[model samples]
Target: MRRSGVVRGWRLVALVAAALAIAVVGVLAARAVLDAPALRDFFSRYPGTTERPEAAPYGFPAWLQWQHFLNAFLLVFIVKSGLQIRAKQRPPAFVTRRNTGLITTKRPPRRLGLHVWWHLVVDTLWVLNGVIYFVLLFASGQWLRLVPLTWDVIPNAISAGIQYAAFQWPLHDGWVHYNALQQLFYAATVFLAGPLALVTGLRLSPIFTQRDSWFTRRFTETAARRLHWAIMVYFLAFTVVHVTLVVTTGALRNLNAMYAGRHDESWIGLAIFAVSLVVMVLGWFVARPALLTRLAERGNDVRRMK
Candidate 1:
């Protein structure tokens, strides 16, 4: 049985490797075609970004830097706890609502597994952070960086995608204005994917699923669960590609803009990035059941199931 399992694992790995190799070859062929005179002229006409409005503001503000770090921190644990909840067959501890809280509520607290409790907690925090981000994004006029105002965005996005696939990424000034591709991606992620994830997650949660309302009737729990997983996969893929471009295009400049809220190639941004990564890693490691149970017990009634 062990030998058979090992063989199956090797076979899967080989299949994945072959698929990746084929994809690389396909991309290279497309890149060659993009190098043609007509295509080159077209690319020159639409270099990636459309014209920015006269009122569009520039520079990564301090609020954006803090929001970026907070989002990254919350996402790490959210993904971790979500996976744990999905895979855990036997929960180590279960949480029930406190009967004697100062806050009044009609529905009693539902008993949740430790992993589920943690996932919900982190998810709530993430949602609140997202709300704050949206408020600040519009209030500070930073929405212009992401929201597509012109129809030219579609063609520019296509051009930018071709440039990326061809591995000819332009190290554009993201601090001032994002390329059409970046703008569209950011808009979709924040406005579409983020909301989709939240909606699907809520649909699958005990509060929503337990009730037999129109929402529950319209969106089945099974469908919500699958969509939620797909959204998570999208987020993972986005993070990988986003980080790869950030590092490859101009690591220092990108990091400076994101972390230090500056355009310079100073080490401060890199240092901050490194520290944030370490903190995230530590949080991942420390989120074991024992620690989680202790944290969950403070507000909820926790009982050891096993």
Candidate 2:
């Protein structure tokens, strides 16, 4: 049965609350059983350093701030539309190609055309944004901050993970240096998750289904759907954890560095972030299926005319 929005929201809240409670209990239990020094030593295997040639020119740039905002904006819509598409229970609407006599909408439910269109639109924008981000990141030498240069990053990441779990909170100064865990997570998000998400999304597209090639044969639609869903879940989890860390670790400094491009501890960054958030919330309401459907139809008409 289709659930009401309020019911779904409450269920989500309950789920998150339960998860947090369980995590808190687990951490407490672990700390009770393990000696303080032993726990610290176990987690402190790999040492992180503030001194590295790769950490030159600290603080966020204007381009980085813009990219970050764009990324967040696109990701919010992408995830929302993706969830809507996945949750569609009714049959999907079909679009027929007059020239090729091809029928699309074999996979998604009929009523999901708007969601699919929005997903594709946002996905395209996200990819373009990613391309720009990659170019700027490499060109500005900021890639060095995210990519691991030494093997010790592995152990250091593990140490950071432990510290986080135990509530000890690792030292965080993103303006200057990222802990091993942050570096690895950022790298995975950029290099691994981004490409995988794109590949899996493409695999589920109508063009891929129309082609009976070896590529489609190897990466079946079923597998692609599963991977796509997993990737979405990964993104959701990462967003939650990343936001939690930012707020708990140091909200002012983190927001300042990201939103204001400054390292100073001030409320200016928070104010900007709040404004961006209001925009995002407004976007969520504005990107309704009815509105998006009209936009998609106009886009299709333009394409047909061309």
Candidate 2 positional error at 287, Å: 0.7
Backbone clashes for every candidate come to 0, 5
lDDT for each of the candidates? 0.88, 0.78
lDDT of 1 by residue, 30-118 (tens): 68867887688778778889888778788888888888888889999999988987896788999987867595468877888888889
Q: After superposition, how far is residue 180 of candidate 2 from its true place, in Å?
A: 0.5
lDDT of 1: 0.88
Question: Candidate 2 lDDT, tens digit per residue, 100-128?
Answer: 22433445422226567678879999999
RMSD of each: 2.1, 6.2
Model 2 weakest lDDT span, ten residues long: 91-100
